[model samples]
Target: MKKTILILLLHSSLSWAQMQPFPLQEVKLTAGVFKNAQEVDLKYMLALNPDKLLAPYLIDSDLPLKAERYGNWESSGLDGHIGGHYLSALAMMYASTGNPEMKSRLEYMVSELARCQAKNGNGYVGGIPNGKVFWERIHKGDIDGSTFGLNNTWVPLYNIHKLFAGLRDAYQIAGNQEAKNILIGLGDWFLELIKPLSNEQVQQVLRTEHGGMNEVFADLYIITNESKYLAAAQRLSHQSILKPLLAKEDKLTGLHANTQIPKVIGFEKIAKLTNNADWSGAAQYFWQNVTQTRSVAFGGNSFREHFNPIDDFNKMLVSNQGPETCNSFNMLRLSMALFLDKNDVSYLDFYERTLYNHILSSQHPEKGGFVYFTPIRPNHYRVYSQPETSMWCCVGSGLENHTKYGELIYSHTHNDVFVNLFIPSELNWQEKGIQIIQNTNFPYINTTELVMKLPKNQSFSLNIRYPKWAESAKVTVNGKIQKINKKPSEYISLDRKWRNGDKISIEFGMKTRLEYLPDGSNWAAFVRGPIVLAAKTSTEDLRGLFADDSRMGHETKGKLFPINKAYALVDESGNYLSKLKPIDNLNFTLDSLHLQPFFDLHDARYQMYFQTFTKEEYEKQKDIQKQTEEALMALEARTVDKINCGEQQPEVDHNYIGEQSNSGYDEEQFWRNTRSFISYQLLNKDQRGTYIEISSLDDFKTENLEITINGISIEVFSNNSKTIRLKLPKAEQISLKIRVMSNYTTPRFTEIRIISNE
Candidate 1:
C-alpha cells in the first residue's frame, strides 16, 4: 500500500512530461568529487541566515521583522531576490539528502511566506522593495519599463519569479502541502492582476528581465489541471521573443544571455504540455544556435552577461568579465528539458561537458563560496561570494547548482533504466523491488561499474550512454565482453538484466584534442573527453577573491595581465596535441606549465584558452599585439568611471532615467538614442577626473544636442567627431544629461567614460 501511494504521487507530479527523472529522495550520491561538492554546498547554505533572507518579505507585508535584511543585492534595489532562491535550495537539498535541518528550514520559510500572504490580504507576497506599491501601480496600468526595470523597480518580475519557483519546488519536491496552497493563491492574484491590462501592456512589462514566469505558470497548470492556469501561461509568454524564434531567426546577439535562456526553457515546457511542435522546434533551434555557435569550449556562453557576436569573440577574450554562472545554470535547465522531451543523446553530451567544466568549476572546493563569473581571459581570476556580504544572481543559482548533482545520474521508465551521467550514485526503484549502485572515478579513471540488486529474476533493458567524446567503448556483463554495435551519441542497451549481485562494467579511452573558438578564431582550448584542461599561470594579483557587500563586489576588479604577455602555442604544423606530454591520465605538461582538469584548479590565476599561431605568424604579429595591448591598458588606467549606455546592469547601476528613449545594438556596439532626454549619475571620486568623454556609434554632426553637467550647460569640445569630450565639474558626483535640441533624435550614444587628465 505504501509503495502504491508513492507510485501514485510520482505519476501525479510527472503526468505531463514525456520523460521523467527519478525523485531526488530515491537517488543518493556516494564518495566522489560530485558528492564532496554537494557536502560543501550544504555548508554554504547553512551559513546563510534565514531570518535575514525573510526580512524583506516581512517588512513589505507590514509584519514584525525578526532580523534586518542582508546587504549588497538583498538590501539594494533587487531586495529579497536571494530569499526566494534560498527556499528553493533548501527544498531541493532536503529532497536530495533527506536532511532534517534542510526540511526544517524549508518548512519555516514556507510558513513565514504564508503569513506574509495572509497579511497582504490580496494573495500577493514578494520580496521586491515597495512591492505592494509597485504591484498597485502595475495593476492600475501605469507601467514604465526598460531592459532591467519596470515601473522604476529593478526586475521586479524576475525577482518574484524566483519566489514562485521556490514555492513550486517546496510543494512538488518536498511534499509540503501548505506551499501548494500559497502558490495557488499567488498564481490567482497574478492572473487577476494582469486580467485588466492589454496584451500590449504585458509585452511592455516583459521587456525587462523576468526569470521563467511562463514556465512556473505552466507548472501550476500541471499541478492543478486547470485550463485557466494554462491560459495564463500562454498569455504570459513574450510575443516579441516568440515571433522571431518561430521564424527561426538568430535574434539573440547582444541580448542579455541569462534573461533569454529561462524564457526559452519556458517555451519548451509549454510546448510539451500543449503538444505544440512549432514551439518545441523553436526551442530546439535556439539550443543548437547557442551551443554550436555562441558557446566557448567550456560549454558556457556570453560575456559580461550579454551574448557577443558569434563571428567575433575578441571582446570576450580581452574583457575581465567572461561567461557568467547564471547563464550556465539556466542553460542546463533548457538542456535537460530538451534531452527528456526529445530523448536525444546529443543533449546529454552537451550537458555532461557543461556539468564537468563550467558548473562544477564555479564553486570553490574548500572555501564553500559561490562564483559569479568564470573569466576566460588568460591569467584572469574570479571572485567568490561570501554568504553574509554577497547576494548576486549567480550566488542564488549557485546555491542550487551543487545541491542537486544527483538529478540526472539515472532515469527510468516502467521497464527500462537509462544511465545518463557517470557520477557515483545509487538509485532505489521501490516499485520494481530493485536497487542499483553505480561506482566510478570517471575522468580520473575511464571506467564505471554498476551492481544491481533484485529480489527475483527480472527481464529489463539497461541503456548506457555512449558519449560523443569517446572514440570506442566496451561493455562487459558479469565477466565476459558483449558485442558492441552502437555508435557515438547512441545508447548501448543490454537486453537481459536480472538477479541479485549482477554486475556490469563499461570502459572507454579518452584522447587529448584541441577545440578552437566557435568563431573560427586562432584561440584554442584543450579537451580530454568531456573535461576542459586549464593551466595555472600565476597568483600575483587575485584581487577581491572573496566578495564584500558592495554593488560590484561580485566582479574581479584586479589588474588584467596583458594579453600579449600570455603564453601562446606556436608551431608550423597543425599538431597542437603533440605539444602536450602526458604526466598521468588526467594531468599533462605543456612547456613549463602543468595542465589539469579545470574543475580541480582553483584559487589561482589560470588560462583555459591559448592563442595559436604558426612560427612565422607569431614573430610577425607579436609586436603589433603588444602595441594594441599597451594602448588599451593605458585607456583603462585613466578611467575614473564608465558606463556602457544601452546594457541592462550598467545603466541601472548608474541610476538611468530617460524619456522618449530607446536602445539597440548596431555594428558591434550597444547604443541609446533619445528624442527628449536621457540622464545618468556618474562618480568622479576625489574629483580626480578632468573631463568626461561621450562616444557614439553614429556621428553627431547633423543633430542639435544640448549637454548638461549637474544641470549646468556644458560646451562640447567636438561636434564632428564620433566621440565628444566635456570639462568635468569639480564635484565628486555629477549628474550628466543629454537633451535633444531639435525635432530630430540624438545620436546613438554607445559609452560614457570619465577620463582622468593626470
Candidate 2:
C-alpha cells in the first residue's frame, strides 16, 4: 500500500469510527483495541486453580498453579479465575484502542476456545470444578450434590458468561468480527444445555454463582438481534432480586449488590432494545431502589458484596466491606446507560460521585490493582492483589479501572460537548478536526484548562462541566469572557468558534464540605475539591487485621500517630479543613492533605468516617480486644515475606484476620495485603443513600431446604448444599416465598437476589 493510501486507510478505519474524550487532562494509558487488550488477557494472569473450569487460560497448565499444592505462594496463582472482569477489561481496552494485535490475540483466544468446545463435544470452557460431572448430576435430577459448587461463582458457567460477554464487548465496542461467532456458539451451547431442564431445575443451577451470563447474553442478543440469546439471558436471571425491583420494593440489603446490578442492567438493555416499556420501568425502578433508597455517602452500597438488613447497617460497620469494585463497575455501567438513553443529569450526578471517589480512588497509587470496596469506617485497610497473583473480579475491574481514566470526561449532544470528570487529559475529536487538551492536576489542584486547536474560522459549542461542588464556575476565552450560567448539576455551554488556537478554562473553584455516612453514627468526612480526606495511622505499630499484611490492614505508618495526635482535631469552626495540608514534598503521596487518599496510607491507620465511643463501652471490650490482638500477632508471625526485607507479610483478609493463613495465601495475600477498607466518618449528616452490604447466596447452598409450589418436588439440592434454587412462574400478582433452611439457628442474609419475568 502506498503511504498516502495507507495513511488515508488508517485515518478512516481507526480513530474516525470511535472518538472517546478522556476525563483527566492527561495522556492516559490506552493501547489500541487489539494490542493492549490481548496482552492484558494473555499476560496478566497466573491461575492457581488450573482445572477449576474457570481459570484464566493464559498461563501454562503446568505452571505450579493448583489451589491444593503451593496455594500459598504468590507464584501459585490462586486468585486468577475471574472471567467476567477480565473479559470486560479486555473488551473495554480493545474498544478504546483499535490495535490489530489485540484483535488478533482476541481472535486467537476465541478460536482456541471454539476448539476447546469442539474437543469436549460440550459447550463448556473452563478448568474449575473441572469435570463434566456437574452436568451429569443435573441431567439425572440429582440436586443433592452439584457437579460443581457455585459461590465465588457457580457451574462457573457464570464465569464463562464473562468470556461470552467479553467476546461480545470486543465485537460491539471494538468491532471484532470473530468475537461474535465465538460468543454465539457459547450462547447456543448454554441454551442447549438448559433445554431439558424446567425453570425450577435451571433455577437450582442458577442458585450457584454464575457471573452475569444473562447480562452478556442479553447484550449479545441485542448486537446480533437474536432472541434465543435473550431467552437464555432471561432463563439465567435470579428471581430473588428482580421480583422486588419489579414490584418497586427495597429488599437489596444483604444481597450481592454488584452481581445483581449487572443483571438489572441486562434487563434494562432488553427493555430498551426490545422496546419492552415494562422491563424498562422495572430496570429504572430497581436503579432507583438501589441508588436512592439503598446507597451510602460514597455513592455505593452492598457491604461484603450483599445488601445489609434494612436501616441497620451500623451493626456491621466493623465489617464495612460493601460496595465491591465489581458492584461499582456494574453501577457505573448502568448509570452510563441511563445517562446515554435518558440524558439525565441525575444519572451523571451519581456517575460523577462514584468516578472520582470510589472508582478513581479504588486504584492503588503504586501497584495499580483496584480495591474491591471503598469501606466507610476507619482502621479497615485497603490493599491490591499482585499483577501475577491476584485475579479476583476486582482485578478484572482493576484492569478496566485504570485503562479508561479518560472515559466520560466529555459527552456530547448533537451540537455541544459535555465535560463530566476532571482528570487531566486531552480530547482529540478528529471528526471536527479539533484537538482539545485539558490541562490541570485534578483532585490535587482544583483547576483545569481546556485548550482547543481548531481550523481557522470553524465554530462550535463547548459545554464544560460546572460540577455540583463548584462554588463559582467561570468560562473565559482569550481574556475575553463568555456568558454562561453556572447552574448547579448542569453543564455550562459556550458556543462560539474560529481559530488556530483558543482556550476556554472553566475554573470550578472547588469547595470543601463535610459528608456524613447514614448509619446513624456521628462523624463526618472532609471533601476538598473532588478528593475525600481520610485520617491516617501507622500499620507497623498494629498487628493482625490492623497490620500492613491483612486485607483490612490500616494504611498509615504509625501516624504521624505520635505527632498526628496534635494535628488530628479541629475547633468549632471547620478551620482545620484547609489549614491541614499534605506536606509538599512527599514523593509517594498523590496529594498532601490532613487526610490522604484511601488507597495510599500504608503506614499509619486512617479513618474516613468515625464515631465517638462511650468510655464505658471501650473499657468493657478491653479484654476481648486483648485476646483478639494476641491471636492476631500469632497469625501475623506466620505470614512473613521471605524475600523482601525479611519481614512478615500483612494478614489482609478478614476471613483470616486472627485465624491462621489459609493455604490460598499468595492469591489471598494479593487481595488481602494490597487491599484495605476506608471508612467515611461523619457525625449526624443527612441520612440519604446509606448502603447495606450482603453476604453470599452461596451460604444458602449448605442448607436443607424443601421448596415446593403445587406439590412439584422443587427440592433442588443435597444435604450440605453449596447452593439451592427456587424457580418462580412469571407474574406480577403471585404471592410466593421460600422456607430457607440452614443448619445454623439463623444465617444472616444482607441481600436478596431477584429474577423476574414480570
The clash count for each model shown is: 0, 139
lDDT of each: 0.89, 0.50
Per-residue lDDT tens digits of candidate 1, residues 1-758?
Answer: 00111112112333322356888888999988889889999999999889999999999999999989999888878888898888889988998899899999999999999999999998999988888888989999998777777866888999999999999999998999999999999999999999999999988888889999999998998899887887888888888888889999989999988889998999998887776889999899999999999999989999888999999999999988899999999999999999877878789999999999999999998887888888899999989888889999999999999988988888776577889999899999888777899989998999999999888888988889999999889999998899999998988989894779989999987888899999998999999999999999888878899998878898887899999999999988977788899999899999999999999998889999999999998999999999999999999989999999988878877888887778878899988888888999998989989999999988875348888999899988655478888898799999999988888888899999999977
Question: Which candidate comes out best when scored by lDDT?
Answer: 1
lDDT (Cα, tens digit) per residue for candidate 2, span 1-758: 00111112112221221223332222343223212333443344322132332233423232332233212221222222454344555555555554454455555555555555565655555434433565555555655312123321233554555667667766765566766776777677667767888898877676545667677777766666676777777777777666777777776554445657777787776555555667667788877776765666566676655565545565335443546677777788888776655555567767877766677566544444446655664554555555434445566666666545455767654345667766555566655566766776665556667777766556666767666767777777877777765586776767776576777666667666666555454455666555566666445444322223223332222211211121223344434344444453111222343456443354345666643334464455456656765664453333211111001121112111111111111211111110111111111112221211212223454234334333343544233332233443332222222333433222222222222221
- Off by more than 4 A, model 2: 1-80, 94-108, 139-155, 292-294, 320-323, 456-459, 541-593, 599-604, 612-758
Residue 382 of model 1 has an lDDT of 85
What TM-score, computed on C-alpha atoms, does each candidate reach? 0.96, 0.68
Could you report the Cα RMSD, in angstroms, for every candidate shown?
3.3, 14.2
Q: Give the TM-score of candidate 1.
A: 0.96
